[model samples]
Target: MADETPPVDEMLYEQLAQDALRGVIRSALERAALPAGIPGAHHFYVTFKTRAPGVSVPPDIMAKYPDEMTVVLQHQYWDLTVEATRFSVMLKFGGMPKVLSMPYTAVTRFYDPSVQFLLQFEAPATIEEIAVEIAAMPPAEVEPLGGDDAPKVVSLDQFRKK
Candidate 1:
């Protein structure tokens, strides 16, 4: 058997670009902490992996979610706190202000329909892998900058390896 396929890995660039965009999620959350309020209808469409490490969604919410969940951040969210490593916020779930604390690593998507700005990220491959990695990593390992080891920069060499 002869293999005629020339190994091409163009999609690696897309992954890198996608990760770069996901960094904006952290930036937006930082801006969100500016005062104590958001402006206009600039709400958020936040989606997360419920089973990610350090994720605390209400049990009922978790029951309904099972694996992943989407939350609308507008009109009723309060006590939004954004720190370099993680964030905590109060949002009404069925009229009860249940606090949900999330690490950025748990967030899979961040979208602001108001301006059409969107960013999406993923946890390498699988759920169990993500959870294990998150639990094993120290706070200093993912702090967005020097505290975290910076990001894993994708190299073009990957495409040239063949």
Candidate 2:
């Protein structure tokens, strides 16, 4: 008897999985945008790349966290809006309110500490994107790191059953 397994298509499954995971963030934000707000004790810690394209934050905030920043979606936030590609919300810092707008692709981490659920993502910038960002930055801020010393994205695949 001949084996009858179908071959996998050439689709990028990793990208597909990433998109689905990001949809979870979008869905959560959509829920939070409603009048009921965030539902029960559920809250989120959303971390994103400060320098990623389409991310908009106050100048002081960009200066302070040039690499990445995490914002908590809890009692103090307001004006939360979630769109297909991006989301924005007003959050207070140092007694002043600032609005942060960012594309979902910029997000690298999403955590719900109340449930201890966490999702981490790889830096979404491509080589060309990274180059463009580095070139746009001031000379003083661009520093090189050895490959081995660079940060890594931890994958859950290793823990999954084959």
Model 2 lDDT per residue over 1-162, tens place: 999999775686877898899999999999999998998899999999888878898999989998899999988899999999999999999999999999998999999999998999887663356566557755553235665455544443433212
TM-score of 2: 0.74
For candidate 2, list the clashing residue pairs, or say none: none
- What are the runs in model 1 whose C-alpha is more than 4 Å off? 1-20, 124-162
**Number of the predicted model whose lDDT against the real structure is largest:** 2
TM-scores for all predictions:
0.62, 0.74
Q: Where does model 2 exceed 4 Å of error?
A: 1-9, 126-129, 132-162
Q: Which ten residues in a row have the lowest lDDT in candidate 1?
A: 153-162
Clashes of 2: 0
What are the root-mean-square deviations of the candidates from the true structure over C-alphas? 10.3, 11.6
lDDT of 1 at 100: 81
